[model samples]
Structure formats: C-alpha cells, structure tokens
Target: MGRWTGWVRWGALGAAVVVLVVFLVAQRQSIDVSYGRSPSSSGTVEEGSAGELSDATVPSVDEMTAMVAADPVVRLPGSIAHWDEGLVRNAIGDADVRILVAPPGLDKDERGRVRDVDNAQLRVLGTEVTGSIYQAAADDLPSWRAQFATGDVTSLLVTLIAGIRDQDTPEDVDLFRWRPPTEAETAAIATDLRATGVHIADGATLTDIPKSAGPAFPDGGALYAAFPQQTFGEPVPEYGPTLAALFPGKPIVVIYGSWIEYHGPNAADFTDVVGASFYGQAADRISTYDYPQANVLHAYLNRVTDVRYAGLFERPLPYLPLDPLRVALPALPWLFAGCVVVFLALSARSLLGPRRGVRSTGPPARLAGLTALAIEMSGLTDEKSDPALTRGITKLRAAGDALEQNLPDGHVGKLLDDAEAELDDTAWTLGRNDYRPFTYLRGRLA
Candidate 1:
C-alpha cells in the first residue's frame, strides 16, 4: 500500500509541474491588464431626463434650428468649445455647425456651466466634403430622439445639420476637447495607451479626443486632429494603433503645413497640450510637402467596425499580438495558487516516503553469476541447438565482457540486471539438459 501511495504522489507531483509550466507560458503570452479601460467611450447612450426643460438655458429644437438657419458662424458653449479650440476655429471656419451631446438634457450651473459635457456622448454633425449636408444627422436623428424626453432638442440638432447640409460651406465642422493636464489623469491615460502597442516616449505629451460622428469618406481609415505649426515627435507606426485604440471609429484629421505640439511638464513652458500627431523636424517637411493635399485618415468605429480598426489584423481579432490578458484572468492567479499547493502537498508526501541510502555505484551483484553462465557456454556447440539460443548465448558473452569494466550504476546497470535474469534462465535449462562433453547442451532431458 505504501509503495502504491509513493507512486501516486510522484505522479501527482509530475502533473502539478506540468500544469505550472503551462500556466507560466500563458501568463507570458497574455496581454497586460493595465490597459483595462477601452480607449473609446463610444457606446450605447443613456436615455435623456424627462423633467421640465430649462426655458432660460435649454434651446428648444425649433429655436436651435432657426439659429443655425439664420447664420453660418455661431459660438459654442464655453463648456463645449474647450474640447478643441482649433477644431472650431480653423477646421470649421464659419461653416454652419450642428452639435449633439449625449443624454440630451443640458443643465446650467449658477455660473452658466454646461454640466453634460462628456467626451463619450458628444458628437459634431457634418456632411461630406462634396457639400453633402445633414445626411449623417438624418440617419442618427431617430436614435438621438429616442434618448430625448421632448424630442425638441433632437429636432434642433437635426435642423442644425439640415441647415449645414443646405449651405455650400467650404470647410467641414470639426471640434475636439483639448486641454492641459492639471492632474495625473492624462499620464494614466498615456500609460494605458502604451500597453495597447502605442509607443509613448518619456516626457512626451498625450491628449485624446473621443470618436467623431461624421459622414466623411473613409480616407486613410481613421480620424485625427491637426493643430497648426505644432509638429510633435517623429511619426511612428504605433501612432495608428494608439490613435485607433483611443478613438476607435474616428478619422485622424490632418492639417497641411502643421504637426502636433508637445510641451514640457512645467506650466511655464506652455504645458497646455491636446491631441496627437507625427513628430520630428522631418515632420515639418513631410507635412509641408506630402500632406498638403492629404485627406482624412478613416478608422473603424469601436462598435460599428471591427476591433482591428487600425491594427494589422494578420491574425484573429482576439489573438491580436498585443491583445490584453482578458482570458480566464480572474481565475488564473487562483489556478496557479492551487497548482502550487498541490505541488507542495505532493512534495511533502514524497519527503515522508521511505528513506533510502545513497544509490549503489558498482555493477549489480547478479553480474557475477551471469558472467559465469556466459563463460561456460562460450565455446560449446551442438548441431541440434536452437538458432535463437545460440544468438542469446553470444549476446550474453558480450555482456559478460562489458560487465567486467565496473560500469557505474545507471542505464548500464539496469541493462546488466536484465541480462542476468536471461542468463540464469538459460543456465537452469542447461542443467536440466543431457549435456555431452565439449558440446553445448541438448534439449532438457525428456
């Protein structure tokens, strides 16, 4: 029983070791959990409040419609304009603009601050470069209306787009929420982006914008913003994945003769930073020469398109080279812990099993009898001898010669032990046979 118990314990121990090895390899291949939050906040929008609309601040759908219909240039809410000043200033440039904020109810503070200015829920409505007006707004208006309590603001947002669509504006409306970091939120965001295969250098500045909702053509397959005269670091391949990861379904806006600007951490060095773009002195030449007629880089939407929006989707989406460790993540550590415990328990059992002295190193004791048997039969011969028996006797003689070298205990020792058993059987058979002098034994005596 104890012998069987030892065997069971060793088997269990071997299984535990194998399990540990497999789990360790999985851990290495797994992506980091640090980038747990998705780069894009674009998702299902919540329903708007049904409470009475604020007559003082909230514009009725008709009023908003009329406002956009009357003029092409209008100022945005202070709360909204802060996202990206350049977006409203240069990108839009007095074109009729229509905006949509998710969870449509807009509340004003005593200081007139708009409280519902979240990046995930806000959208700027625009048409194609060919002057295609509010077509995008028409498609999304129903969804927007479903979220509103009155649908009046929805009408206003829709009408705003319709007005832009009717106008022959030369520029498309674009705006982003750009700001300098007053806290570590930006740094934490940058860290998260890095884990998703984005290469962010030390002291490099990072600012992100939410996905854009527009009907622009799929240019380079993504959307990015270009700030004037703001050339950032050298444009690395990581920028596409990083940007796509952040703004999954948006296009990367490119400005001719410009690059993104990065600043030092110090406030005095113009620490105000927002958006990402290619960097380096070479960027100056590239942007100036090659990008002058560049169209927007179109990207896949987080929900509307595949997750590999800007990624090299050589493999399945889940197996992205840098995919995060999301598989069995909550249970992996526990499994490893369990394996370790099992391994320890099995080790303990092995330690408690019967103790033995150091392994013997010389030839097995049975080698002497085997050698004697081989010598006695070496030169003996008989015409009626079985061919198999003759071969066996020859092999045994060779084993006997090899055994004299004092081979250390190991595989050689094990092989010699087998030889001994074979030789002993042969010797017993020979003793039972009617042997004749100077001849090998005949069959056992009948």
Candidate 2:
C-alpha cells in the first residue's frame, strides 16, 4: 500500500484510541478508587477494635510471647526471631506458617511530609497513622525521643500497633512499622541483636557491635533476611513475582524498598507502611511480636513458607506514576473492550494487509519432504511451473537447512533433504521448458 493510505488508516485508529482515553479520563474524575487509605482524614473511620476494648497499653516482649502462645501454630519469618518457636513449642501438626517481614523504621524528609500533607497526609506523626496508633502518644514524641536518648530506658515503644485487615486479598499478610531506633535509643541493642541471632562479629566485644563502625558481625547472622531467593540485596518492586516464582507455593514476603529496619531494630516514618491502612484489605494478616520476632528472619533458610508485608523502614519504592489505564479506565470491562479493538484493528490491517511485501504471492511453498516424491510421482513440471516451481525450490532449500539444525540425528531430516534435492532437479528441468510468447504468462515468466 501507498504511505498515504497507511497514514490515513493509522490516523483514524489513533483518533479512536484518543477518544477512549478521554472518555476514561472524564470517568475517572467522576469517581475514585484506591488500594489503601487516602492520607486525608476528611472522611475516614478508625480500624482495629479487635481483641478487647481494654486499656491500650504498650505490650511487653513477654506479653507478646504469651499472645503468640495462644495460637495453634505460630509461624515465624526468617526475619522475625532467630529460632522456630513452633518447632520449639508446637510442632506436631496444624502449623500455619504466617509469613512476615521485618517492620519499617521511621524516617521521612520534607518531601515525604509535604506529599502526605498536601496530598493524603497519611504519614506517621503527620496524620492518621499518628491519630490511629498514637493519637495520644504522638504529642509526646519529643519526650519519647528524649527517653530513647536517655540510654537508660530498658524497653521503648510508640504504641502504633492496631487492627489491620485486607481489602484486596484477604490471604495477603500485612505489617506496620512507623518507627525505628538509633544505636543508643535501643539501650539493649546487644540483647536485641542476639534475639535476631544475626551473628555478632567474631573476636569482637559487645562494644564493637554498635561502636559506630557498623555491626561487627562475622558473616552476618542467619537472621540476615536470607532471600527466599536472596538474589536482590534489598527488596525491589519487580522482585515480587520473582520471589513468588522462586518460593512457589510458599507465601510472599515484601519489604518495600528494603528500608532501614532491615539493619537494626529502629528507623522512622516511611510512605507505604502496610499497617497504615484503616481500609487496606489485608489488615487481618498483620502480626506483631516483641523484639523476639527476629526468629521469622531466621526461618529464611526453610524457604519462607509464609509471605508477609513488612514495612520495616517503610520507605516505599519510588512511587511509579500509575498507568493512565490503571488510574482512570473502566479497567475490567475495558480489558474486554481493548481486546476487541485490538483484534479488530489487527484483523482489518491483516485482511487489508499490504501485498507488495508478501514473501510469496501464491499458495504456501512446498514442504521439502513432499517435494521429491511429488516431483517423481506427478507431472514433473506443467507449462506454467517456472515461477511457482522456483519459489517452491527456494523454500525447500531453506527447509533443508532448518531441518539439519533442528534434527541433526533424526532420520526424517535426511529424508527431507533427499526429497528436496529431487524436487529441485525436476523444477529446474521444467523451468528450462521455455516458449517465445511475449504475453502468455507461462512463457513470459520462463
């Protein structure tokens, strides 16, 4: 086809796609849907009135242990505690492996604080996360940070744990961590590290572990977040499926951006902390543990039978600008619509497909195996065999080469080559039968 004709057809299709996009944009403006909570509190309800309506006191590690004991099988992540309490406690049967990742540490810059405030304001100490977990405690952050700085406080907390449920996949696990710790703030950093069981550097004193140079570990601990498929040092966005693929039937543990919490017990405010969802569907999967949860990470060697969302560090992967379709289209139905359009456009382009570029303007070329027998068994060449015969011969020679590579040891390949050679000879003979007629197609081609 001419270039002008191709452009005209393409322009028409382009206009249609634009119309669809515009219609979707307008439709999106009319309604909005999001995976989790909007940062705004203008219209939101409180989540997690689970357990009891008792006083909301910060839980102690011992109390956290008792709570875990209540379960039939408390599955832990390699990122949790250093050992499997299930094997240590309840290992007979009914072991439900509830996978989880390390919780996030709190760290937000002005850009993050501004984004949440001007947009959703969903961050810790900035908006609803503050209101939900520590509406009462947030006011005392300075005191807490100071208490943390004291270096004398044995245990510390921000009191942000609450009811988490899933709005998307109920089976999906959820996690929330809006805070982290500096070396001194933990006070018992040595004990905490031991709980995670990450090896302390050999020949190094406890003072060497947190003396500012970095944790003096020998080869890093077993709790070092062993990859279910530890191909990526930090959890990356694209690693979700790759992790799933590697683990197969086991669950998926996602640590958004591999936040700071992976290094130690503490850090601060992150953007996509999973537990912030008052409405995030996966809230029911949220699990909390005292510092002892490090055993979960220890289970990484067991192939991580459970999957979890640990917002440790809470630093979300850089928010990918949502696709125009995901943000605005009638996606589900639009999928069918898109398929229909694509099929039609392809079909139209095919049926009306340009003819000049056609490799052969005739019936399919002959299979080499059939050619030799056909040449010997039938009219070797008709009066008009030149063009068709030439094309078929060319195709047969190609098939022979393809056959050689594809079936080097096979008997069929040898047969195919032999047949092709016979056919080519017959075709050559026929093609040589020429006529003088200038206009007769058979003679003209010859």
Each prediction's TM-score against the native?
A: 0.22, 0.19
What is candidate 2's lDDT per residue for 1-446, written digit by digit as tens? Answer: 22333455566567567756676555644543333222221222233222211122323334334434464322222222122233322221242322111221212232232223221111221111322222212122322222111111111111222221111211211122133334453334334334653323222212212211111111233122211211211222233234333334322322321111122212123212322221132111222211112222222211111111121333232223557755655554465466557656655744643211112212123242244435443455564444444544555566556655664423443443344433433443454322101112222223
Clashes of 2: 53
Lowest summed lDDT window (length 10), candidate 2:
148-157
Candidate 1 wrongly placed segments (more than 4 Å): 4-56, 69-446
Q: Say which candidate scores most in lDDT.
A: 1
Ten-residue region with minimum lDDT total, candidate 1: 437-446
Best by TM-score: 1
Q: Give lDDT: candidate 2, residue 24.
A: 56
